[model samples]
Target: MEQNDHLGQARDVTEFPFGADFQSILSLIGDGVVSTDHTGRIILFNRAAEDIFGYTSDEVLGGSIDALVPTRFHDRHREDVDRFCSSNAPLRRFMGEGREVLGRRKNGEELSIEATLSRQMIGGQHIVTVVIRDVSARKTAERHRQLVASEVAHRLRNTMTVVNSIVTLSARRAASVIEFKEAVLGRFEAISRTNDALVSGSSTDVSFRLLLESELAPYRDDDSKITLTGPDIALDGQGAVALALVLHELATNAAKYGALSTSAGRLNVDWKVPVDAPPLLDVTWQERNGPLVAPPTRRGFGSELIARSLGVHGGTAISSYAASGVGCSIRLPLTGAPPLPQ
Candidate 1:
């Protein structure tokens, strides 16, 4: 067994023998602990080092440290090691300094790592020890967090744009300040309900059924008066918010003058998206058992908002006040719907 001493000289180290007990203690450590002499030849490769780099202690003994580092970093690594050995700095860090720490594996793959280096005199010889930790999982988690944050920011910006459009158009159509305030507040409430549904879901956006149910939740009771029937359909950020406002207006109209206004009244909301290159949402808002209906003498701002809320690219809305009931059939080009699950 080799010995080390206070003077750091091989011959003088007889006072401190390197034994199996010392090696076993190092092997128990979680981080890879690698030690090298003045020549950068690895003298001790602990079990954790073998697990990290896929190299056995016998295979890496007396080997240069470069074998464990990426090719691009070999030169800098050697230079830094030389500096550390010559300087009085007791310890050094070589990861997370606006630079990545990489380690090469026996299979030629490079892995992310963090390491701390320290130098000491043992029996008159310079010895360098490094404590290395694998950081790949941490790096992956950080990237995922960044992606989620960016997605949330993007959705918030789109929501603000939708709100701005609603306020601007409502203000232009209002005859009085009170009308403008009520219109804007109602639309904002719809958006708030939609966002609440989104918070309950695991994804960044909510499903179409969830958004619809949220808008009509106030009236739903043991009667199952408010029902949603459609395939599970995911809506993108903007689509969810826009559709929520439209549904809220429909429910408001129903509660005030349509089926929801009477105990015996019934409302049926059914939607379908036919298979096409770009699918279209066919939504039917039918009211039954309500007061005799007649076409409105003048179109209201609420009706106008429902037509304009979905945007102007391609959409159709037709409302009829029949003798039996009041209803609307809307065909909207569904854009930004999520892909079907695998």
Candidate 2:
């Protein structure tokens, strides 16, 4: 080891024994290699170190190693270095295995890095070497994984809440145990179908046409009885789930009492995207050729579910009991919908 006192008076490593081999070895190291004296002054700044810290070897040779560390860690860094140098242990020690430290580049950008420290007594001179590797990419990937996990947990909670509400409402509306069982099982099946559509697509949102098609699948045997008219619009998570529940309730009621209850009855569903700021989708559900309709004396679970679902998104569902049949006019705010010529 070449003995040099203080900064700026640092000597070229080539002047020391096997100095050429020492310099050659430092150049070939893939990770940043920084050697400092007992005083924490840098003595050897390698090529990899120059690339990692965004500094030329000449620029940092006589500088304090603290320059590479973020200001927040300066105190801890100094304490750790001092303790390591004072200890009698001669073996190398790994630093920041799972916990990483921040490294400051020449451009002032911060990086996540892991470091390994080793001390050697060469010719009675204590030389401390630190090998650093950039781990910013790994840290970023870990954070992304955590975020996805959190989102999945949140979605699962919301799904459970919706299922519980369905159970409570189904029991409240049914007169017999068989009726309750059918209602609950049917609604659960609808949710499962909706989830299937959600995952089948590559996108997070589902197509408006697809959402409606899934609920109206059983009635599609007679195309003349079911007329669906609208440009395909995509619905986000909240919108997709809300509209699915609303559609299932409407279809159920129609099958039990309205259009789908009679062969002569017909169901027509049409929607249009109106040209307006904060776009809106105007939909009409009209039943024709069924028994004369009359408003119910009391609202049922279906009515309550439709109203609540639409209300969450500042939308409205108005049921009309015309003598011809049952009809509903729904107005909903649609986000990120492409405006089509109406």
Candidate 3:
């Protein structure tokens, strides 16, 4: 009887110091902890486990651990447990390993979790402990990042397509070394201006007003040759670049052989957004007081550039000669325009 009392006193002393300590450790853990016996019956549910699965220790302790596993995985999980128990070998611990698994909550909702499994021996009986962390938020963030990357790549490819067309058309028109160099430089300048506008807005869409002013800067002087008349409109990057190249070609042609070549010649530019029908931008460029004008016997670089650029966005340009002067009208589908700035 005396020896029995001594053993009981020893047990009480050991348990007293560890009761609060073990509880504190479990409470401090960030991941859910679930312990089950070799038979797969739950034996311990830590504070984090309760929060994660919406189950109290008392409610889960004597229940099957399979309750916390997704229904689809329960059969395979059972077989794994049986295999481990029969082999008398501990399954590999998964701490710090990024393994994805499905975990079930009290309401039967399945959550994606990263988990670590470990084995412990207590009183000659083997127990398995699982530590689970919810990874749903991380997975969602990764998906969003991937979507943004894909959109950026697609926009870049579209931008390069416009750049390629501009370079090809400009290179074909150069008759002399000096002319080729000037043409290439001119095209590069136009692309730089468009890129600057896009960067300023931090978006693919650019302001139509900005694009026109930038393209006409080189030709604008004391003479009031370039004019704008329209409510402000926005153009997506691809549309803006195409339009810039079209205007450059027109201005270049006029300077070399058309209206802008003479002292009295001037170009009138105007545009409007109609409320009725699908959105349209009607731009008219009329040359006055220039030398006698006639359509080219063969299509030139300027003509091809204008046609191809407009065609990129399903648009067309019509050039006509009236008794007054040569008039060029461009009609573009405004589908490429950006939403009005708030």
Q: What is each predicted model's overall lDDT from 0 to 1?
A: 0.78, 0.81, 0.75
Q: What would the per-residue lDDT of candidate 3 be over residues 176-240, giving only the tens digit for each residue?
A: 87987788777768777887887678655787778878876766774576566766788876677
lDDT, candidate 1, equals: 0.78
If both were scored by TM-score, which would come out higher, candidate 2 or candidate 3? 2
Task: Kindly report which residue stretches of model 3 are placed more than 4 angstroms away from their true locations once superposed.
Answer: 1-19, 29-89, 92-171, 220-225, 254-269, 272-275, 279-294, 322-327, 334-338
Candidates ranked, most accurate by lDDT first: 2, 1, 3
TM-score per candidate, chains pooled: 0.70, 0.73, 0.62
lDDT of 1 by residue, 269-308 (tens): 8888877647877788888897777788898866877777
Off by over 4 Å in 2: 1-18, 22-30, 37-100, 104-109, 119-127, 200-204, 222-236, 260-284, 289-291, 311-315, 331-342
Clashes of each: 8, 0, 0
Worst 10 residues of 3 by lDDT: 6-15
Supply the global lDDT for candidate 3: 0.75
Residue 197 deviation, candidate 1, in Å? Answer: 1.8
Winner on lDDT between 1 and 3 is: 1
